[model samples]
Target: MPVLSTVGGSGRSTVAGLLACALSAMGSTVVLDTGPRLSSPWPAWSSEPGTGLLSLPPDRPLTRGQVHAAASRFPAPDGGSWQVLTDHQEWSHPPLPLPSDPAAWYQLSAIGGWQAVIADTVHPVAHDVLTARWADSTGLTARWCHLPFSVPVLCAASTGSGVLALQTAVKAASAEGLPLHRMVVALAAVGEGRSPASVKAAATMLEPRVRAVVQVPYDPRIRAHGIRDTSRLKSRSLEAGRQLARAVVSSAEAAWGDPLPAAAVPRTRAAAQARVHDTARIASKKVPA
Candidate 1:
């Protein structure tokens, strides 16, 4: 299972939802809202309110049957299926379920063969549980952790402290030898125009710790409406969201040495070629016209 932990403020819920949407679009079965409290309803979970990811009995090791049963609940888009697990009870203390052994918790997750697990772990209990798990296992990979591109995003009146807490958690994970795949820097609000300078500065500051920095431009629809299960997003915003999601998936694929499907290879190459041609044309036009 490829698990991608999303660490950010309340805004992270939107990112997690968008990431799940992107993976689903690519034909990958993705489990969303695996944490205690689901941030958004996108990629809806079938588990009843009282039962969630954290509710599973730690004494009884998770079995393939249980995995299948849990997965059966969430009907995947287009015919495929993805397991959607929530945290037991809307909120709980860290180390969800209070796993007697932290390693067992991760082992259970690894058994699912999940292509990706996007968690919006913003609360203290959620953060503590994740931190403990990361501490217990030095071998697990840290795909990406989302952050704000500017101070304003962190200081915004509505913003919470989860962003800062997530940063600290990432730092701790990095010190333990887990690779920080990338730091996704998102703007505080949409339609605020591109803040290139802030984005660049954020990338520079985070470069030392992460493999790369990804900039997710402010998309008003995401901020205004929040995550939704349907595919009725504004066309422009949907396109932009897809672009960011593609970049993240591509990076993850490269890290894991996974090959893109044969059907997608040609299209991927053509897209690369188109970018090159576009760049060349821009340079040529700037020469004299």
Candidate 2:
């Protein structure tokens, strides 16, 4: 099962949304908002009807039929064939309690041929549930961890509390042996303005656990028109998001020992090397060289 864990500022939701669009554009019928209430303001599914997570009974054990029903609820956007499944529930503003049978629910979802499941999560809850589920599900593996570029307003609002929370969560997940694939660091800026250094700093702190760090240039159009659909984004943002998603997918495939398409492997390797080169350059510049 393809699972993407997006951990960053609130904008992670938007990143997840863009990924869903990218997957759809690639002709994979995707399930967006697989987790409980969506954190980002972007639309969970594509314009196609019935492509989102199924709202299920959180308090009770979910029956197979209930699971199937939930999957059936989402129709393909093109009225074509597709699979469905339930993601985590969005209970409240902060976060809801983990479902009693998270493993079973995750397994049931995996039965469907879900190419990807992007989860937008908060700190402790995101880490706890994903780790538990990954350990339990023989089929499930983490594809990537997304971190959006830090916005000054968001930083001021977070007041350093968010960074601390992220660090703590990453430590906890690592302790639990969660395989963190890649970390996509988004820089949501207007023009030539650089992404906040704090964002890169946070990503650097996560490097040991996060195998890759991708820089996604910020696009003002996403905020202006409220980029709910991938088509709504400029070509640049869409291409950037797609590249990040591909990296995440490659990381997951490598971890599982699954063979990837020959054409894609070289590009992924090149991207990884580029990241190492960029990090080395940045580090060299930072020193008294």
In the order shown, what is each candidate's alpha-carbon RMSD?
17.5, 16.8
Candidate 2 clashing pairs, residues 3+ apart or interchain: 34-87, 35-88, 36-88, 36-89, 36-90, 37-90, 50-74, 149-186, 189-218
TM-score per model over all chains: 0.52, 0.53
TM-score of 1: 0.52
lDDT of 2: 0.44
Predicted candidate 1 versus true structure: per-residue lDDT over 149-211, tens digit per residue = 100011111123433444555565556544455434343333455454544454466657554
Q: For residues 68-155, what per-residue lDDT tens digits would candidate 2 score against the true structure?
A: 4455232322343333333433444455334333243334344333445444333333455466665774222222221111000011
Alpha-carbon deviation at 283 in model 2, angstroms: 65
Worst 10 residues of 2 by lDDT: 148-157
